[model samples]
Every structure is written in C-alpha cells, then in structure tokens.
Target: MKQFYLSLIAFFTWVIGMAQSGGDSTRLPLTDSIQAKKSTFTIGAVYANDASYYGQRSDERLPYVALAAAYHHRSGFYLTGMGYRLLNDSARLASAYSLGAGFSFPLGKSFTADLSYDYSIYPKFSPFLQAANPHSVNLTIARESVVDLSISGDYAFGKTNDFFITPQISRDIDLFNIGRNDLVSFNPSLDMTAGTQHFYEYYQEEKGIRDSILGILMPPVLGGSPSEQNPTIKTTNRFEILSYNLKLPVSYNRNHLKLEVSGQFSLLSKQAQSQPGKVNSFFSAAFYYQF
Candidate 1:
C-alpha cells in the first residue's frame, strides 16, 4: 500500500511539472467518480473563492455559491442543472444558471467516452468572463491505467465562437478506509489547454464599452489618461496553448454522501495579452448527497 501511494504521488508530481514547463484548463469527466449500479439522483452545493475560464479572469474577485442537481441513469444518460449566486457587491442577485445533458459509455474494458451539451444563462452585465459563451458542446475520451488519462474537445458559442482542447492526467490515492462504505482519498490532476481567445475578446469589448460610459459620466480628472479610460485590447484569435493547471482534491465518501475540498493553481501563457505569464490560484469546497 505504501509503495502504491508513493507511485501515485510521483506520477502526479511529474505530470504537473511537465504541464508547467510546457503550458491548461479544467473540465472533469461527465460521469460521477463513484458510480452506482442503478440510477441515482444527486444534489450538491459548492462555494468557491473565484471563477475563471481557461485561466482568464476579471479584475475583481468573483466568489460564488452554487447549487446543483443531477440525475444519472443506469443507461449512461445524465441531466444536470446548476444555479449560481455571486457573493460580490454587484447589484445582480443571481449570477448564472446552467443546464446540461450528457451520455457516458464505456469504449472498452479500460476506456470510456462522454458526449455532452451545456447551455448557460447569465444576467446582463455579468462580470464573469465565461459569460461570453453561453453554449458549449464537449466530447471527452478517457483511459484508465495506473493513472487516468483523458482528452476533451469543446466548442463554445454565443457572442463569439471559441474552440478548446484539453489533455489531462490524474490519479486517486486511498487515504483511509473506515468501513466497506466509507473511505477517504486524495486526487491530483494536471491539465493543459489549447484554445482560441474570441471569448476573451468579447469580454474586453464589453468592458471597454462600460468603461467608456463611466468615463463620460465621471470627470476626466477621475479617469486618468485616454488610454486608461479606454485601453485598446489586442485579441489573438488563433488557437494556441493557453494555460497549464494543477489540481489537488481530497474527498471523503460515506455511503451516499461525498465531501470534497479542492484547490487549483494555474499558469497562464505569455501569449495572454492582459496578464501574460500570470499565476492564479482558486479554492473550493463542495458536498454531494446521492439518492
């Protein structure tokens, strides 16, 4: 058991180091980690320090609390819904809502594939960067070995269209086994993402419009230079490596309930115009009850 644990740790460290040296994004497989033999319904809640999209974020923190429900059929079809409330000082009480449907199936003994579609609804003037793209279709292929390997392709569209591809490696290490139905484990994963930044361009355009309006309302003394008031945004529409991410999640499973705490560290690519070569961290805690 000790040797197995050490091997998992070594694999996690090596993969993340490679990602940082090279350039990532976050999207887990559509199916639940702990699968049930029969159909199941799950309700969950999450609290996060901030939200980002492919490692792009707004200037201010975007903390949020979210509630989610999912129904998973034994036939591998699932439907999910989530609602988010931002904890910031913005006047918007509800930040976003999402509805998703997916089908997960085994490709073979050690491989699986998931195809999913999601639509997001965001309040007008929402500050979240991901709000620009409201519709997304994703296909993920995963392989199980000593470590899990997965790759996903996503096409997102709304105000603009963007495509992203993410490759990831992860491992789960058992920490403690209290009983047949209760256990704790640590999961570490690393991912790299390559994508087009049209969504980011949309965000900058909206921000510029808002800033211009504010500058007109406020005085020139308050708004500094013309560049400061309405800075020119350089947009890169070509697909390229965007970010690398390392994620650490510890989970406790007790029968039909699971609790998890996770943190992610992201290194943004130098090609990112506004925050080139920036590093950002995000943390979240969540719980799910399955019935």
Candidate 2:
C-alpha cells in the first residue's frame, strides 16, 4: 500500500513537470493575469448528495455551509480562516471546520507553488470522525499550472496515519460575453485522489475498533433495536485508490458576485465497499461574494 501511494506521488510529480515544459512553444498556460486584491472573502454553501474526495467520501448527501476569508501578502504569504457546518445527522458526524494558512509563489514565472498547514476538528464519534481526538493538523504542498497537483499528509488523529494525493485539471469555456466586465463561463474539472482507506470508512457497513467503541456507548439504533443479521467489520489504514471525480461548474461572474451551479460525479474504486444504490454523485448551487 505504501509503495502504491509512493508511486501515485511520483506520477503526479511527473505530470507537473510535463505541464511546465511539455508545450512545443514552451509557453505556460494562462493564469490570473491581473493583480488580485490583497484581501478577499468568500461565503458559500455546498449542497450535495455526498462529499467525495481522494482521501474521504460519504455515500450519503451531507450538505456543508462554508465561509472563507483570506489575505495575500505582497511577499507571497497568505493566510486564510475557513469554517463549515455539516447539515443533517449531526449526532453521528462532525461540523464546521479547517483553519489554515499558506504561501504561494511563482515558480520560474511559469508555474506556482503553494504550501499550507491546517488544523481541523471532527466533532462527532463515528468511524469517520472522533470528537475527543486532538485537533487534527495537516500539511499540503501544491504545484499549479493547467493542471494542479497537491500532496497532503495528516498527523496526530486516527489510529493510522494518512496521505491525500490529488491531481486536478480544469478547463473553462466562455458561453457568451455578457458585457466587458460581465460574462458567464462553463468550467469543467477533473479531480483524482488516491489515499488510505480510513478516509472512506462511510461506505462499508462494518465498523472498526473505534466505531465499535462508539457503538458501545450509544445504542444500536438510537431507541431502536439491533439487527438480526451480522454486520461486516473491517480494519483501517489500508491504502488504495479513492476516487475519480468530474465536476461541471457553470458560473456567472458579474463584478464581485459569483453565482454557480455544479454537478459532480465520482467513480469510486471497488474497494470503497459501496453498492450501486449508494452511488457518489451530486448537484450543488453556490452564491459567493468576492472582494
């Protein structure tokens, strides 16, 4: 498993190198050509059938309300405060998370690099999260181009350590030029994550040791009865490919306000233990005010 993840890391690294030097003209992809404001705030909500990523996934739709405020320094240093709340079934999972800061700098004037650290909390006791655990700290390193690659690691949390290696590529097409300062664009993106099984515990009906402990504390069904059939129990920390996600985000950007509606489909690996009925797909609409 470790070897597979290491290979995944190498593969993305190679892709980044190719992106930076692959073109016949040796020109880089277009990035933010204008100088962006130093400070910005984004407030939005994501309503989806499930939260799917390389390191984690929920077979069920759990909505997230999120807010973010960030400041970028002239020296390439940036800090951000982020928070989110999970809607529905609050008794079993966590809500409102991730405070982080990072730095982004130009790499040879062709690519960009970012490094960040984050501390997050999972407020509920389930196979997926532990409220009693220490504030989880994670570090991420990223290289950006036409395709972006991020490698992150989590420490001091669950019984087994984990890493999230993701590669994301996005393309944008202008549906129409609404005006000089206003237009709508259709953005399609592909994000792939490969990591440990701990992030995908939700798909399996079986409970691990930590889940068993939580179950022991609470009744089998919350004023309900135990099932007659046996449930499957699995171990944790097994590494595997997590998901391949494709997202279509249609955004209408008019000045400082951005409105978007998107649908995401994820083809999770067979190891996810998810059935056809518990598929990973969702649609979401978001409103953001950026300044």
Compare the candidates by TM-score and give the number of the best one.
1
User: Each model's TM-score, in the order given?
Assistant: 0.84, 0.65
The per-residue C-alpha lDDT of model 2 at residue 251 equals 79
- Clashes per candidate, residues 3 or more apart or on different chains: 4, 3
lDDT of 2 by residue, 1-291 (tens): 455447556645554444432321111111121135354444444455455444235434456656655555656666666665566656533365666666666665445566666566554443233222334555555554556444555444444355556667654455666888776776666666665544334323334344566554434554544432223224336655566666777877777677778888766665543431133667777666655
lDDT of 1 by residue, 9-74 (tens): 776777554432211112232357324557888899999999977766686788999999998888
Q: How many clashing pairs does model 1 include?
A: 4
C-alpha-based local distance difference test score of model 1: 0.77
Residue 78 Cα positional deviation in candidate 2, in Å, after optimal superposition = 2.1
